[model samples]
Target chain A: MKKKLTQFTAYFIIWLLLTWSLHFQEVMVGIVVALIATALTRDLFPDEMIKFLNPVRLLWAIFYILYLIFYIILANFDVAYRVLNPSLPIAPGIVKVKTGLKSELAKTFLANSITLTPGTLTVEVVEDNYYIHWIYISTEDPKRQKQIIIDRFEWILRRIFE
Target chain B: MSNPVAIFLITVGVIFDLLGCLGLIRLPDVYNRLQAATKSVTLGTCMILFGTFLEFGFTSGGIKALICLIFVLLTSPTAAHALARGSHISGFKLWEGSKMDKLEEDKGK
Candidate 1:
């Protein structure tokens, strides 16, 4: 029941954000739409939906977004420099890095973060191991690779999702 | 719109879009091309939408532009990840200059 309410609130908030209107008719329609949508997707959400309400986690999530955008811009310039360089200097490779996070949601966030930041793309995830494609193979050691890729985002993600 | 910031952002976005296309053409292999193109084009498109938001303010069109930006940010990397995994699973080869293939190594064991 609480999960249903949480989902309803989420959908209603999205509806409000999308419409940005306060008319009685609009609000009524928005509520109905959110209800139907929530009912339809009731069982799809993880059981820990209520954890999203924690203020500290919410703060960390906002921080994560700002952190992600900063890295993304930095990453773009780094890639742009390589792409424009005369030699096309890339030492591309697929490397495996392990994550200690147990939650699927956190893993997804980590993978998405990896894809946008620096010169890395997460090609696959097998259990706790992520197979990432690196644009530059800076080090061959697995621990250093994990430090560079997963560690940057994993700790914050644990706070938010785990 | 007469907003110079908006115009400037749109101009930078176009340059990034152009670079992304160039990377698609110039890069040696599928994974390399995916990396370069996805990063550049996704950011380029987001910048363009954000510029539109700045130009239009809080109107419906502007709000929609923000929504589109969020959707692009959420989905583009996911789509690219899917493509990279699909191609690798189906046996696409990395460029010869690539330094390692740990995914392949895992497959061997």
Candidate 2:
């Protein structure tokens, strides 16, 4: 019964968010038709983790979205500074770092985060470690670079999901 | 709380961020730069966000900043680690300064 309620709420809230985005007459009619279709197909699956009942978590997700916007700005500035420099000033290299995450979701989130950040690209990650490619490498001590991301980003991830 | 305190936090955060950026520019290899950028930016961002919180009080922006601060701290390193390990597994060349390519040998086995 609870699952059914959650599923219904998910469909309703999803419809609400969709309509909020597209308030056109044709779109609204299409949205209503699509929502009815979704409602009919709802019980075919058991749990999608798509329940909309967790208002706190939803708020947290929205807050995270806002956070992404701010960080992306900072990231853009860093990338621009590198691009605008007199010399092509990039010391690209591949570095390996350790991961302390205990779950796959946490690890995947971390990987996506690295990719999302402009300068550094996530090359590969396996069994609690990462192969990261950075556009530059100013430090002789590899640990210095490793610690910045590890302590800075990965630690925060520990709090949010795991 | 005070203006100086807020400024101090923001400065420190920016310094870390700058250091990270500086490291990326000066570093030799991808692995090396990833080390610098992720660490510096994440920590620096948090510090800056904390300062923003102090300035803005417990409003939506402040709360949002705090949430972002937390997110950066969490995802940045894990991403770095994944990339590094992936590169190692995928046979991307490591730096000349690297003391060990043990992962390479392990992969071979």
Candidate 3:
């Protein structure tokens, strides 16, 4: 019951933000939709919404998003440079790297981040190991590759999710 | 829009989108092309949506643009991963100059 309420509240807030209207009719409609949606997807949410609702975790998550945006911009420039260079410098290959993030959500977040970043696309995730297709095959050592890929984002995500 | 910042952002977004298209044409293989399309196009579309948000402020259109931005951020990489995995599973070979195929090795193990 509590989980359903939390889910409804979250959905309602998103609806309010998207609608951005204070009209009573709209608010009522949003409440109805949120309730129905929450009822349908109750099992979809993890049991503990408390972790996500923590103010400190929320703040860290925001900062991590901003940092991710900065990294993405840098990645775009790097990809653009490599693509346009006359030499077409690239060493494309798949390399395996490991992540310590235990939760499924955290692992998904890491994989998505890897794929979004330039020069690295996560081709597969087998257990804790991710097979990433890197545009530049800088090193064959898995530990070094883990440092290159997972280390940058994993620490911050660990705090947010774990 | 008359907003200079919005116009500039849209311009940069278009340029990045073009560069991604160029990469699709020039890159050697399916994997490389997927990288270009996923990274560049996602960033480009996000920028364009952000520009729209800035131009419209907190109005309905602006909020919709923000929603679209979030949708793009969440879905593009998933699509790319599916494509990459599908290609690899179907035994599509990497370019001749490629270095490793850890998946093949893992399968053999």
lDDT of 2 by residue, B1-109 (tens): 5678778989988887787778677666667667557656776888899999888766656666776776676677666666666656666777665444434644655
Compared with the real two-chain complex, what DockQ does model 2 have?
Answer: 0.08
User: Model 2: per-residue lDDT, tens digit, A81-146?
Assistant: 664466756666555778888766667766766654656667666688776566665564658867
Task: Give the lDDT of residue A48 in candidate 1.
Answer: 75
Q: RMSD of candidate 2 to the true fold?
A: 9.9
Q: What are the fnat scores of the candidates, in the order listed?
A: 0.68, 0.08, 0.74
lDDT of each: 0.92, 0.64, 0.90
Most lDDT-accurate candidate: 1
Candidate 1 or 3, higher DockQ? 3
Q: Per-prediction TM-score, please? A: 0.96, 0.49, 0.96
Alpha carbon lDDT of residue A155, candidate 3?
Answer: 92
Q: Write the per-residue lDDT of candidate 1 for residues A50-103, one digit (tens) a residue.
A: 887899989999999999999988888977998899998899999999999998
TM-score of chain B of each: 0.97, 0.89, 0.97
Cα lDDT tens digits, model 1, B1-109, are: 8899999999999888898898898889999999988899888999999999999999888998999999999999999999999999999999999999999998988
lDDT by residue for model 3 (B23-109), tens:
999899999999998889989999999999999999999998999999999999999999999999999999999999898789777
Per-chain TM-score, chain A, candidate 1: 0.95
